[model samples]
Target: MTKQTEELKQQPGLILQPGPSGWWDSERVSSPCVLRCADGKWRMWYYGGDPHFDREINLPTGRCGLAISDDGVHWERVKGPLTMGAVFEPHSDPNRFDAAHVGVSDVTYNNGLYWLWYFGGDSSFTQVGNMRAKGLRMQPGCAVSADGWHWLRLEGPYRGALLPVGESGEFDELFCGFPKVVRDRDGSWKLYYHTLHPEKGFLVGLAVSEDGLHWEKAGQVLGPGSAERFDERGVGTRHVLPIGNQYVMFYEGVNNSGYHCIGIATSTDGEQWEKQDGDATGGSVFAHASSGSGRWDARAVGTPCVVPQSDGSWYMYYIGANEGGSDELTSQHQIGLAVSKGTDYGQWKRWGE
Candidate 1:
């Protein structure tokens, strides 16, 4: 996959879409995070659900909104979201663990405040194995926010699951969700998430934190591949970039026909990794978009968020899906973008496709 990752295929385009009637993403919008604020303005935190679970639309377990953009491709939806309305609701003190539902998988602003990482589901995955035949569990949480729109759960409201869940048959026990963090230079903190590998599917794991509120695992750095390749069957929603000293993971792979693409791995100390090969299925640098077949996100793409553009160039907010016949998968998914400049900024190209 050279010619610069095949000129970076599929070329993502739709910037952010999903919402039009009564708001709260009317029907979709999945994991996205973009921040570039020091007053320069440009903030975004995403997640919009009700993908037809339709419990009236305002409370069905998927919230995490807040948008604003001076040019991150036109956005503006600051009408309130930080989960003040409850969707998954519960937590009425039923002995906590996110009470019953909560899914907000990435948001970080370290040291000064604002840090949220989530995935808590006590049941209700609709259909599709009901979280593994009703024994139900999907935990991996943490919360805190001083100004990023009000949030608090460092240990209280539903007691955010810090990082610990694998026991019975372990590999992250039963489930874990998307979380990709980085902070090293001695300050200590480097997480990367995605678990549920009782058989080598959905892999990516590694944990360690110093003050971001306790965490320590440090087990699997990345996994799932070679069952045919292209991410063999599952790899995990991730996003990490720290170019200079190494460490650049922008994941979400999944192939074996379950679709999903976008890959790249490299680590110097973030705990050993290397995936960057070529063609036929040699460590995809990016996938999905067999020419965007019928639009609205050709068919599958990962949840990767990369932002850094005060002029230095690089913006890659991702989450795209279309194959809605099965009622769409991955939390309804939608939101896209891609760009790069000086030095190729990691050679992406789906913003004008």
Candidate 2:
């Protein structure tokens, strides 16, 4: 039987802070993708943005970044080998789909190849948002890498999004991005993402792909919370893990109060999901430490990246913030880590804490 994960905990010891005051990543680093290679080395791909530019533009100033770690806990940024500007590709032409900004949220490796799914900012000339939301008609871009380090992006429709936003009145009418893609046992690709609903702040949606490049939307998999629930405002940035014929998805949830926490849901088919909530906490599976501790993530948590460690254990890489508790931050954001004993996926502890 698949163990029902009751909770995921956070520790204070594992944290990767922002870059120095003058560096490109001085403000925040989020949306981490961790891959454990056969050689036992850990490589991470994350996005960084200037807090000032993020608020000034009212959008994600996300620039793709890289990090390497011998052990999952210790880390160092890739300065020279990564081409300091952008690892994948950046928006240059205003006519392109990702003219404003670009950020990579999901990545996969199989048979010595790497597949990346990135989210692009609003278009330069067109209107892509829905009646409720008005921002970049966010979409997913595809890229392949011979090695996890170097990449070659697609062009034309191949470079375009795997699944564009839904038509009028669809669940993903406003915007859809933050892809969490994985291959099922049947060799089909299952892509999960978060989108803005007309009434719901943000929701989770599913798409399927036959070749990891071509995709088709399935529908909304998860929705917002009740008026008084923790995820009442939104549920964004999901990470899906397949375990024993059941799939577990970890999501970033926002309440009406704008408090961001981690939530979990379970699915049997990867298409339908049931929110796993706390009877007392209103379904929040994971929460930040008390603000009194002055922890880096006291304010909120989002952008979950879950990787399976050797020896049957697991590691989760996520971003944390202590101010303005939503996805958009007025303050700094940092990277944090959590660990799970190989015995159970439902239980987690702060890495090295």
Candidate 3:
């Protein structure tokens, strides 16, 4: 093996799994929004479900919870006030956009408060092919917390959504979900979200806000990769980090076989992007373990959240799945970690390695 490959170690296993027995996330858990605060305490906000959760919805998102860690490795769950110990949940108002289910996407600490950007779907259902999907019309929402437990939502237009679905024939005509926000140096804000199109597959789009509340759609920024590439199916949930003079995006790529992996792309202006080649084939910076390897993340890996460490390394917390099920979306998912080899962002090793 090359020196670069030898420096990396394979991921051992999942760092966090489903909640304890009878908790809200006892069934499955995914989509982590983690942060290391000024006090050096690590907090993670993620969404998941229980046995009684509504099965009509396709995704695992139902309620949200919080986990704390001091070393960013071992984690302890914090019991919340909501039903079955959830920090935040879907809106109770049926007229609101997120009345059905919600998932935490990004959380930022600013001015002594926690700002949460999340996506949720209403009770309404839509007919896709032969299946009638409930809570499929997703949209983005905002909420603020004083102690990161009790939250108060900031209502928005279009039934409490910060931005509504695109008009007919638009790139985001389906829905705008997974809101990842980046505050620019000039005081403006940029929100990144993704939507899936029947023909276009998955595409990432942008919206800008002057004050972090009101927003305007800025159109598509990134889309599917070239044919037969690691991300040929499309780019999904991602994290954007401003590194020195350039903006780096750690994004999830879906292949034709429905396998998921992590990829890297760089942008000078944070609007347009160019994919960078990685150690893996098809330009993926990191990929799933070999098929039938009996690894937790062998089937797919996605919804990446990258954090810079104090020692000049990087930590990536992502969701991993196995091939126990027929389709990837229906497979059981758990959260795992990977670290970059030193400060080389393009090279990574699993947590234990």
Index of the highest-lDDT prediction:
3
Q: What are the models' TM-scores?
A: 0.31, 0.86, 0.95
Report the lDDT tens digits of candidate 1 across residue range 1-353. Answer: 64423322443477666665666566777777887777777877776664444342222245567677888866766766423332223245545665554557577786688776766555343222333232135566766777777776667222456675677777777655566678787888877778756457788788888865678787777787776677888677888888877888878787766777777888888788987654423357656667437665566777888877766788888887775544343434677887765545556777765
Which residue runs of candidate 1 sit more than 4 Å off their true CA positions? Answer: 1-20, 32-46, 49-103, 107-115, 118-179, 182-188, 191-208, 214-261, 266-268, 271-273, 278-286, 304-318, 321-353
Model 2 TM-score, 2 decimals: 0.86
The number of clashing residue pairs in model 2 is 4
Instruction: Score residue 253 of candidate 2 by CA lDDT.
Output: 88
Please identify which of the two predictions, 1 or 3, would achieve the higher TM-score against the true structure: 3
Clashing pairs in 2: 11-350, 122-136, 277-283, 278-283
Q: What TM-score would you give candidate 3 relative to the actual structure?
A: 0.95
How far is 81's C-alpha from truth in model 1 (Å)? 10
Q: Which model scores highest in TM-score?
A: 3
> What global local distance difference test value does model 1 have?
0.66
Backbone clashes in candidate 1 total 5
Off by over 4 Å in 2: 1-13, 51-55, 80-85, 123-135, 156-159, 278-281, 324-329
The stretch of ten residues in a row with the least summed lDDT in candidate 2 is 1-10
